[model samples]
Target: MKFNVKRKVIMQKNSILFVILSAFTVFMWYFFFVPPPEQSYRQTAQSQNTAAVSESGDNKFKRADLNESDIDNIYVKEEYINIETKQYKAVLTNKGAGVLSWSVKEKNGQWVDLVFPESAPVMANFPSLTYKIISKSDEKIVFEYVSKEGWKITKTYNLSDLYMHNLNISVEKNSKTPFPQIDLKWGPGLGTDSKELKENISLTRALVYTAAKPNKLKKLKDNSEPASLCKWTAIDNRYFLAAFIPENSTDFDKILLSRLDKKHPCSVILKAAEPKDVNKKDYSVNFYLGPKGYKHLRTYDLGLEKTVDFGFFGFLGKIAFSALTFFYKLTHNYGWAVVMLTVIIQILVLPLTLKSFKSSAEMKRMQPVIKDIQTKYKDNPQRLKAEMLNIYKSQKVNPLGGCLPMLLQLPIFWAFFTMLRNAYELRNEGWILWVKDLSAADQFMQFGSFNLNLLPLIMGIGMFFQQRMTTVTSDLSQRKIMYIMPVIFTFMFWSFPSGLVLYWLTNSLISMVEQYFIIKKMRLSS
Candidate 1:
C-alpha cells in the first residue's frame, strides 16, 4: 500500500512539471513570436485621419494673430553682404548675430532660400510667432515681426567685412524680457498641410548651446527649449527656408555662420539681443544651415548626428546600415544589394543552422524513446529527468540546439528589418513586376476605397505553407495554435514595407527548401 502511494505522488509531480514547462513554452511563443495587433490598428487610423485632414483644406498659420507686439521698439539694424564663390553666391549679414538671410542661386539661376531664425517673439495667449522679410537690398533690409511677443529682440550679422568672410552674431541678455521665447522656421518651398505641420514640426534636430545654463539641461523637454528652437517655413515657389531662434539669455546668444558660398548649400541667420549699452567689441555666435547630408553636417564639431533615430533597436540598425552601405557601393542598387546581403548572411550562418536542424531531427527520432521512458518512469519524477538526460547524452543530441540557432539569428533578423525600414535609397527603387517601390506596399489590388497588396497575401500563404512543412507537434491543440500564428503574422505584416515582406518570403522559401533536403537526407541515411 505504501509503495503504491509513493508511486502515485511521484507520477502526480511529474505530470505537474510537464504541464508547467508546456505552459511556459506556449507563453514565450505568444509573447515574443506574435506581433502586436494594436500597431496595425493605430497605423490604419493614422492614415485615415491624415487623408481626412488633407481633404479638409485648413490653413494653420492664418488662424494666428501674427502682427501684434507687446514690447518696446528697440533700435535694430540689418545688413546684407554678398560673397561670391566658384559655385554660388551667399549673402551674409551683421544685422543679426549670424547670417540674417542667405539665398543660393542654382546653376539654373533659380534662387533657393536658406534663411535661419536667430530670434523672434513668443507670447502667453497667441499662437507661435515668426519674422517676415519686408524687403532686402545690397546694404540694408527690413524685417517685420510676424508674430505676437511679450518682449522681442532682433539682429543680423554680415561676414563680408571679415577677412575670412565668416560672420558671428549674438543675442545678449533678456532679464526684463517678458515671456522670453524664440521661433525658427524652415521647410521645402512646398507648404505642409496644417495637420501634418502641426504634428511633425518639433525640434527633431538642433546643435544646442548649453554653455549658459548647464544645470538646466535636465529640465529641457522633448519639444520645448529654453534657449534654441528650430522650425520650417515655406518662403516662396523657389525656396524652402528654416529659422533658428535663441531666446532670453543672461549672456550673448552668439553664432558663427561660415561663408562657403554655394559649396555650403545653405545659410545660418541669427536674430536676438536684449536692450543694453552699446559696445564696440564683437561677440562671435556660431551657427549652421545647410543640407542634411552626412558630409555637410559633420563640418560642425557638435554632436548633431543624433537626429537619426534608428528606432528602439538602434545598435543592430547601425551594423545593418554599415553593411548595407558597403554592399550598395558594390552593387549600385539598394534593392539588389539587400537581397545579396541577405543571401551572404544566410550562407555564412548556414553551418550553425544546419547543426541546429540536425539536432531537432535527432530530437524527433528520440521522441518514441522519450515517450517510453515517460511511461516507465511515470512513478519516478527525479529518475525520469536523469533517464531523459542520459538518453539524450547517449544519442549525442542537444535539446537546445534548435533554440540556439534561432537566438543567433534574431539580432541579424532585426538588423535587416531596420535596414529595410530606413534605407532612403530604397524609397523609389523597383523590384519585380507590380512592386515598383520596395519601400512602399505593392498595391496591386484595391477593394472599394481600401487597397490590398499582392506581397502581404503571398507572405501569408508562404508562412502557412512553411509552418505546415516544419511543425512537428503531434498534439492537435498545439497544431491548431501553431497554424493560427501565420494568420496573425499576415495581418501584422499586411501594411509593412514591401521590401520587408520580400525578405521574409525569401527567407521562408529558403528555410523550407533547406528543411526538405535535410529531412530527406536524414530519412535516406536512417
Candidate 2:
C-alpha cells in the first residue's frame, strides 16, 4: 500500500512535467523563434589606419591627416603615452590627446583590439583634441591645450583599479572669455574586428542610460531641441562597447547627435550643458571600455549590462547564463563549462527522456500488429478506431508518452540557444585546439567562400546516428523523410557559432547513448 501511494505521487509529478514541456514545445514552434537586440563589447587595440581630417579642420578637434606621406610617416613613428590596468591597456596620442589604442586581455592570454580609431569620432574634451602632456604619473596622465584666446585647458585622466577611468577638465583664464558650451563629440564608429563594418554598423549607436531605463539612439539630429538626460552614453556594437558616464550630469541636460559621413555610416553625439553656474568650474566623467560581460558590467549597477541582449527569452537566458558562469567558475574553460551545463541539464531531464524513449520503442514494436489490424478492418473506420484503443490499453502503452516528455524540454533548449548566441564571454574563449573563439564558427579551411566547419559536420553525423537509433513506427515513407532532417540541420547550422553547435552536438551524442541503453533494456524485458 505504501509502495502504491509512492508510485502514484511519482506518476503525478511526471505527468505534470510532461504537460508543461509539451505545451512549451508546441507554443515555441507554433510561433517560430524570434529574438531581440542588440549588443555587448570589449576594448582592444585594433586601430584603423584610415584617418579623416574634418573639412572645417577646427583646431579644437584637429587630427593630423596623415594623408601626406610625411605626416603619415611621422605619426606612426611618434611615441604615444600608455596606461595599463590588469584587464586593459590604453594608448593616448599627442595628436588629439585622443585614445590611439585600447586592448583587452582575454583568458587565452591573447590581447585583442577594441578601439577603432578610424571609425570612432572623438566626442569629449577630457582628452582634448591635441594636448601637450604637462605632467604624468603611474596610472595617471594630464594633458594641456591653450586656446588662441588665452584660455589654458587641462584634461587629466586617471585609471581606476576597475576597467574604467576618471576624467577631470579645468580651464585656466586670467580674463573673462565667454566659454562656448562644453561640447565633446564622439563617434564615426567603434572598431570592427570580426565582421565587415556595414554588417555591424547598424549595431553601433549611441546609448543613453536614464533613471528609468536605457535608450538607444541611432543619431541625435536636432540640437536645438532639449537633449534627453541620462547618466551615461555608449557607442555600442555587436560584441564590443564604449560609454561615457558623467560624474555629475545634473547640469548636462542637452545633447546633440549627428551623422559623421556616408562612407562609414558614422554617428556622433555631442553631450553638452552649461557649466558656468556650477560651483566647480571643472568637469568630470567616467569612461568605460571593455567587453560586455554580465558579471563584469553588473558590478557598477548602471544598467550597462543591458547592452548584452538576451532576446525574447531573457529571463531564461539570464538563468542559463548564470548556470553557465557558475560552471565556468568551477571548470575555468568555456568549452568545459558548456559540457558541464549539458550534463547537468541532461541529468535533470533523464527520467522524462527515458520514459519517452521507452514509449517510442514500445510503439515501434507494436507497429506490425497495428498494421495487421488496419488491414483486418480495412473498410470499417469505426471498428478500426475501437480496435486500436483496445490494443493500446491491452498493451498498457500511452501513445503520447514519447512526445510529451521530449516536448517538455524545448523551453530549456531555446533558452540555452538564446544565451549562447549573445554571451560575450564566449567570443575569445576556446574549447580545445583549433577551435578558438566559440562565439564564431569553428571553420578550419576555406575554399573561395565555402568554408569547412568540422563541428557541424560531426553534429550532423551524430544526428544521423540518433535518427537511425530512434525506432520508427509510423511508415517507411516517414522514416525516409526523417533521415533528411539531419542533412537539413547540418547545413542550416553550418555557419552558426561554435558554442551553439557544440551544445547541440553534445546533446545528440548523449541522447544517442541513452537511447541505445534504454532500447536494449526495453527489448530484453519484452
Model 2 residue 376 lDDT? 89
Which prediction has the highest lDDT against the true structure? 2
Candidate 2 local lDDT, residue 255: 50
Which runs of model 1 end up more than 4 angstroms from their true locations? 1-276, 279-302, 311-313, 375-380
Candidate 1 residue-wise lDDT, 316-389, digit = tens: 77677777778878977666677777777788779887887787777677768877887899788778877877
Q: Tell me the lDDT of model 2 at 342.
A: 88
The ten-residue window of minimal lDDT in model 2 covers 37-46
* TM-score of model 1 (CA atoms): 0.57
Per-model CA lDDT versus the true structure: 0.46, 0.66
Candidate 2, residue 455: Cα displacement in angstroms equals: 2.0
Model 2: runs farther than 4 Å from truth? 1-86, 94-96, 124-132, 148-152, 171-177, 195-199, 202-205, 213-229, 254-270, 276-280, 370-398, 444-451, 471-473
